[model samples]
Target: MCSLLRSARALATTVSLAFIFNASSVLADVPQAYALTDIGSLGGYSVPHSIDESGRITGYSYTAGGIRAFSWTQSGGMINLGSLGNDKSMAYDSNEAGTVVGTSIVNGQYRGFIWNAASGMSAVPCPPAATCSARGINSQGVVTGYTQIPGGPYRPFRWSGGELLEYLPTLGGSQGYGAGINADGMVTGVSYTADPLPHAFVSNADTQLTDLGSIDGTTSYGKAINSQGHAVGYGADLGNKSAFFWSPELGMVPLGTLGGPNSYAKGINSADIVVGQSQTRTRATGFVWSAATGMLDLNEMLLGDTGYFITAALDINDAGQITAFGKDSYGRIRTLQLTPVY
Candidate 1:
């Protein structure tokens, strides 16, 4: 009787230990990426729109009454990049050299501005009677965006220092918007042609534009491009939008949602990691997608107010860091940063 009791006790102990070991191994396999921190506001609301390789961040913040552009450093605090003239300004994108570019409301009209440590904020000169906006700037100081031509349509423009050159014309529809540009001067955005369909397009350095048709049964829009000419954006899937990653080799590959039907791939880093937002069963959440890990929600990977609705990931860097915006329970906009736990 004593020997049987001892054997039963030992078997139970071994089973318990084996269970713990297996549980620990399963937990270890879970991805380690998570939200680093919330880039809090400057007395009001803040949203981080872009991050560079060095972990420098840029975006817009609303103060007591007006909006102001801001840049955040890894070690330094958030620094205000003041406006061109009026009370409203925004930093949409930044380059590796800390050069920031975006639009500013000056004298009651919108004008593009670029800022650097040396030059401060200066208006991107537009043609007489044209309103220009700079959307993206590459490391070489080349800016690409759009300008409204007098009595004509909005056309894409590229600025190298002081010279502003108009690139390929719009796809015959009335309007278009330039969203992103790469180091190679390749531009991507949405263009409306004769079919009245707003399709995504990629323009080469020589102004040759090619329309990257939507995933079957969807209308598409291009958001960002990386150095290797890969584009990331969203496309409607029979009325539901899903994030997409595109390259010359594979055309448009859908980055499916995180257990939901809607997803938007807002940014792509050089490593091909895509970041965006998706809809779960309960609410909207931000997600990072890679070939290795299918999709992960920012809220699940981070400890925070899980009730917040992550709206969009504006940009990501080579280090796998992401900058994004969302709405809190109070319906106010909030910015968040996610860092990879490698």
Candidate 2:
């Protein structure tokens, strides 16, 4: 994500965001089955990285000096979660009660931060001069992500209560990241397994980390986990990456791509519905999958003139709204929300 923001900041510009789902394209005045609304940027580019059940979004917006983290809501719109006296910050996840978490650049290094409406944005402490970021927060206010010491690989961490950063156990190697956390205080992320390969992991309330074996039994990285302990992610297998749905009952269920050999499962809702990106031989495609529906291309389901060629789905809410990154009618990348009308 840091790498992506760096590229977006370099290509930042004012893009006129406008498109029409007219009758000439698909249906007449039947109303859009899914409305794709642009979440405008603060300056350069705005990407909605994660969305909570309440439809609150948190991501980064590139500015003139640098990028800034932002929190957006239907009623409140976009609010810039300012940096820690620096020019860059990127938001990753928000939980119930409107608390946002991410990383902020402070004194030339990246550090974690928790943003709230009343208290504003404040730094969550770690080792001095370390690159750290918070990825997800649960309703219990526990923030999870990774922290890196100088010249060291990232180590997954948990911040709870006041100023205590707890490092979770690694599977074997020194690198790890906590990408998503559930209401049960379970965290899902990637950790190097015994083979020194990235594999999905889950942390219990006791901070005991469990390795959820990869599809290839060699490489995997977890993305999201629902309240029911079902985790979703991607794993390299047969020289190709594939999206997966993992649970205690079924283990890892592969979600094949749309005629391509690559797919990723980014976020999962309480209903076990998963959404993410997939390869289509030529370009990336957004996908939504479930036990009942399997894996289906989002663009195919979004009939009419939605004007969105979604390439990735970052998050999905319980109400079936998907926050995706895609190109507009003119091929400009935009953050859009697809709310099912039916």
Best by lDDT: 2
Compare the candidates by TM-score and give the number of the best one.
Answer: 2
Q: What lDDT score is found at residue 151 in candidate 2?
A: 92
Please write out the lDDT profile of model 1 over residues 40-86, one tens digit for every residue: 77778898878887888898998875899888886776878889886
TM-score of 2: 0.87
Q: Lowest summed-lDDT stretch of 10 residues in model 2?
A: 13-22
Model 1 misplacement above 4 A: 1-31, 303-311, 327-332
lDDT of 2: 0.80
Could you estimate the TM-score for every candidate?
0.84, 0.87
Candidate 2 on 131-178: residue-level lDDT in tens? 888899998898889999899989998888586788888998878998
- Pairs with backbone N, CA or C atoms under 3 Å apart (clashes), candidate 2: none
Q: What total of clashing residue pairs does each candidate reach?
A: 0, 0
- Model 1 weakest lDDT span, ten residues long: 21-30
Residue 325's lDDT in candidate 2: 82
